[model samples]
Target: MNGLEKKQDQRRRFLRTLYDATGGRRLTFILAPDIGTKLGLTQEEYTSTTDYLVGRGWMKWETLEGKASITPAGVDEAERLIAADAPQPERRNIPAPVIAEISRAFDATYTHAQIDNIFMEASAPGAPPEGSKLRKVAAWLHRINADSEVDALDIFGRLVREFLARPRWGTDLDPHAAEAYDEEDSRFLDALAAHGLSYHDGKIFGAGLLAPSKTLAELIRARDLTAIGKEFERAADKIASKSLGPLWKVVQRHLGIAPTPELDEDLKRVLGGLASIVAGVGAFRTHAGDAHGRGPGAPSIEPRHTRLAVHAAHTVVTFILETWKGSK
Candidate 1:
């Protein structure tokens, strides 16, 4: 074939591979190398043809973060082309990789039978021929648990919040998961109040409680930790650790506590460890915190990573407040 013909074939193959791999989310972003290898195309072909395809309305580039999902028109054309090119075989069972991906994405272990049942429902009449994985999973959950009164979006949205495969910045953690964290925040405030350390006037020995606590709250809500992570650096200054470092000195000097209480040795060690836990939160905020820009090649923050941050912060605050109460 001529060079022009070869180029056309390469583009066609790449689009097809992307369609199959993402299961027609109509939108998905995958790594550049992965895309190139999957379609057996050169780096130039995969990257270069994106604009051409977009102009033709075959796909839309959502971000510079390596997005390559098909547009609505692209999906229609892709489906038609796929149908014409090959026979639609019976899906007796869903692909293992697809199931495995879902399992890993949601951290919920699922059996093949469970997945197959979901696949059957999703592939029912009038349903999308090859809907996205979350859609199928969501639909299955919505049907099986109608008595619970939860919708598919929440059922699936929780999955996305926990482990959406997309490269995006946002999170609204499930209420069940956030209960402990909320209770800890409330307890921390209560402890502060008991010690006359109001959040508004809660400074001890010149150190202060966290202000605009909204930064972490926003991080949890929107999963846009980079912006909130940036704010954490500033918030670090308010908490007496001078930027999430060891909180011992801050707790002692600023919060007006003894260097070491005359408690049992074991209890002292535990309290010291708790103080370190608080310091660790600060250190993470300063070091590997997602407070900076994650340009084209950067990855979205993992749910587990954010959980670590939130959990650590709450644990530290709660511990400090309790310790302060004990001292008084």
Candidate 2:
């Protein structure tokens, strides 16, 4: 290379070695000949380069015996240069099955280009020519997990759920009264039965509330979230078409509830929060609950979710029973 290029390379190397020796701390040292020799430079070249670097504000040259140390800025520049010079990590030409697994976990179909783009961003943690989204995601998932071993797509699923709950991230999710609830074998049945939905210990688990059974034992039992969710869908459909009058026109007609005559409050918390979300409950049951055509994106439900569904059913059912009894 030309003299100028050679000099530039030498200066970059000098900063790098200084950075390494000090560990990014301001390590003071005399301008020793050996330090220069390590970089294949004579004492004169080393001392001169140090002076030039000091002038560049990459490091501090102290007064005591011309002691030198790298500045924080020098370390950043050294790292930047080193990162730029580092060889690119060999890109993996991802296979189809791998891509399909990721696509299924995310509940979306992906094109080759989309996968390439996400992988390109997610692959290396700023080590690649382009930066990375995957490494950031990986770090986040790792932080959240203390012991669980998981795949890249599994991590992606968790992140989606996490973002789906946060206010900033879940704006699209828009917590409606519906779709608000969970899972286990013996995990949530008692909770389910307590709400008077449906649960059989061993047999006929996960059936939605098909008939208006008085107790959980009488109802078609549910074993899983999907089964319980089906019951909610049935109840919502009945209420919407029946005198319950959907989410919008309820309460005043049947439950003796209406807007306050003074302030004109529509009683949104009960009507808006609880009743309105019923729609989402039906939708959630259809999409992620134990319904058919669940497809690949159905999130595994937690027990808490099942409680929400069962409770909603209880609220509606209790209201229906109470109204029916009063009339009789």
TM-score of each: 0.28, 0.30
lDDT for model 1: 0.51
Runs off by more than 4 Å, candidate 2 = 27-32, 91-328
Task: Tell how far residue 227 is off in model 1, in angstroms.
Answer: 29
Model 2, 1-328: lDDT tens digits are 9988888888988888887777777665545344577889976678778878888898786666656778878888988988998997432222233333323432332333443444344332222222243433333333323323323333343333332232333435654412232112122333334433233211212323433234533332423446446644655565636423363344344445443454335554564455555566677677666656555677766545665777676676555445534654
- Candidate 1 at 186: error in angstroms? 26
Task: Say what the RMSD of model 2 is.
Answer: 20.0
lDDT of 1 by residue, 260-313 (tens): 667678867866676677667665655555466334554344435555666667
lDDT of 1 at 26: 65
Candidate 2 lDDT for residue 127? 26
